[model samples]
Target: MPQSTPSVVTIGELLWDMLPDGKKPGGAPANFVYHAACNGVAATAVTAVGNDDLGRELVSLLSDNGVNVSAEVNDYPTGITSVSLDANGVPEYDVVRGVAWDHIAFTDEVRGLVEQADAICYGSIAAREPQGTRDAIYAMIDAARADAVRFFDINIRSGFVDKEVISRFLDGATILKINDEELPVVARLFGIDMPDESISGQQEVMRELRDRFGLDVIILTAGAAYSIVMGHDETSILPTPKVEVADTVGAGDSFSGAFLAYLLRGYDLATAHRRAVEVSAFVCTCSGAWPAYSDALKEEQA
Candidate 1:
């Protein structure tokens, strides 16, 4: 049901991740939009940045990498997160507060883009901030076409999400992307008690969530183990491929991006699920979230 070129828009934070070695461009929505564009979509990132050198460089980095950047220049300094990688390459973030992205505005241009977008992705991090930006994100989703793939990637960070906020986003989402680590949090937030923590138990929770929210699709990713995709009538489960890890900074975001990209291109559910797993596995072996596509990745998309 997509046009010739599926147009995708991601509305959320745009910031630099201060990793142990150095800084890199990151933010769930920005990373998602970048990977979506890499997989052959017209992808745009909508967020705010400071009127500073870092902000200009961040915008330029995204633009140079094929993502259309629609950023509001504001007075607050650009956002940054200190990322510390554990022994297994998992990341723990200390996110800076009161940054530029907390002040995202709803301009006419952003409204038009959202209205026409074939798919839109947003997360909880940016919406957890000052009230105006949260309202703006909701407005953008409300303006999207009724059939648009309103993807809600519940990127829950500490002190950023609660039951009320999660429920509000679920009420509007057509597709929900969650990971194993966040699944328990979501279950508790929704008051869905999980007596069994096995794979089947998780799928039951996913099914209940899908039915409750009237969601068309629900993707549950378990890092380094497996992933599951539950469609309206079918379910696809695939084990995660083993790969050497640089860091897991954006592997999950890459999975969401690649899955949506394949779906938009008319691939079947199973095939899309397989390709997304491959893409995320490839991302795991790379350094940052937006790595250059290797031949293996290109072939997987083809």
Candidate 2:
């Protein structure tokens, strides 16, 4: 059954991040679901896992973190990613393919949750790999309520992204979040290579994406340089807050979650943007993605 309050749904992969030291649960959408729940949103994860030990552990971790996840069990093995970190704690992932989440078939449970969701989050990877769940992923995206915020996180991983997949995701997305690295990739895919001034170039790129994709809001994140939120005849450039370093594995996902959670809770866009930046910076100071929300982070939670 759906909850009484509005729900935020993350529709994508749930798998283990096999770190150099040990393993932890960390997929982009899973990280978003975890951080959204931590920041006081009614969060649900709509993805699949294999009927295996790894799958069981992933479910237990989600439940323990206060996320609602009764994922469908697949016959394949659970997804896993091997991670290695740089000196600055930036992580590189060898994300596995042909895992369980790559085949999320349409079901009543996914349909019910999505139909009632206020915001539905999805990544482009769900369409790239294996190509089995591509139809099912599109079906779930179509199932969202008409007023729901269809947030498309262009989480480009490895070489999985393609022009067709990116265009397909943009067809119905209300909001877009892209990092500096991926911005160039998007431009190249769209056949744009214009050179302009620093700020103007960024704004123009954002506007191009907005106009091309019919996005209501465009969030451009430049790690440690600045973050730009463009919408409604205004552009806000917020400098990335400096913080003590931890691995930046899930910082971007946290930003996406916090921004949407604040909006779902009725805060203004500017405030929500600020909160997202702050929360993401805080996450960078912690060890992992789903850090406990302590006195350090100030979210207007229930």
Candidate 3:
């Protein structure tokens, strides 16, 4: 058992995802930290929010969900993404630029938190435009313990991520969590030839990337199909649990959070991968990125 609670810090965007029904609190880092906190870790969200009603609501919601907010208040408006769900419940986002989260300021306090973290998760989207935010993210990653789990969830949002940013982030990542949709894109970007479309071929591609980046793990999640977790010597592949479709807003982020949480708590890789799958399935059945973890939900996971 851990001597104390495991610390997980996520530095990235924290914004409201404007859905068709209403605005839902959603962002990769926010959702990741929220799930990590819910799973009984000391999770902190190191991002920025606008000093506005929307920002206040976001902070309050995160606190209510058990995530510690180490957010900076900035002059710009809070970040918001207009989300449209397809018939299959997959989301297409029209993200707003120049928002508050795009202007995160690196502070000594954030550096301290990163230095002590057991795991840190960041993404490409948050570091896309703002040069300062990208620098801050790099600094925090540098400050983290050498043995820390540096999870880079390459959340390649449209019009945001490119080869340069993705390659730089991968350089520091111990674990790279990406979806099947993104795998091909990355493969093309890096000129890694993918001649076959079989599972073995996919694993080969993943292995090549892992070796190139010195990554310890590579998680390839195929929504509604299967997910593969590849470590240095072992690989665990599990079919995604079938559940009623809601919206896959933060399902992938939840998986990364749960996986890291279990690992930090001393669980074996297979067990951690299993639990992450279960948690991600539960999130897919809920409405927004963050569904209330009521007693029933807790029992289901148990």
Best by the lDDT measure: 1
**Candidate 1 Cα misplacement greater than 4 A, ranges:** 1-3
Residue 269, model 2: Cα distance from true site in angstroms: 1.3
Alpha-carbon deviation at 30 in model 1, angstroms: 0.5
Give the Cα error of residue 83 in candidate 2, in Å.
0.7
What would the per-residue lDDT of candidate 2 be over residues 201-259, giving only the tens digit for each residue? 87788888899888999998998888888886877789989888888889999999988
Residue pairs whose backbone atoms clash in candidate 1: none
> For residues 1-302, could you state the per-residue lDDT of candidate 1 as single tens digits?
44698989998899999988888999999999988998889999999999999899999999999999999999999999999999988999988989999889989999999999999998888888648578888898889999899999998786676677778889999999998878888888888877687899999899889999999999999898999999987999999998889999999999999889888888888988988898888888887778899987787676
Candidate 3 at residue 34, lDDT? Answer: 87
TM-score of every model versus the real structure: 0.97, 0.94, 0.97
lDDT of 3 by residue, 1-302 (tens): 78898999999889989998899999999999988887778999998998899999999999888888998998989999999999989999988988888878779899888988989989988897758688888887888899899999998787675777788889989999988888888998999988686778889899999999999999999889999999998999999998998989899999998888888888888988998998898899888989987686577445
Worst 10 residues of 1 by lDDT: 157-166
**TM-score, cand. 2 vs. native:** 0.94
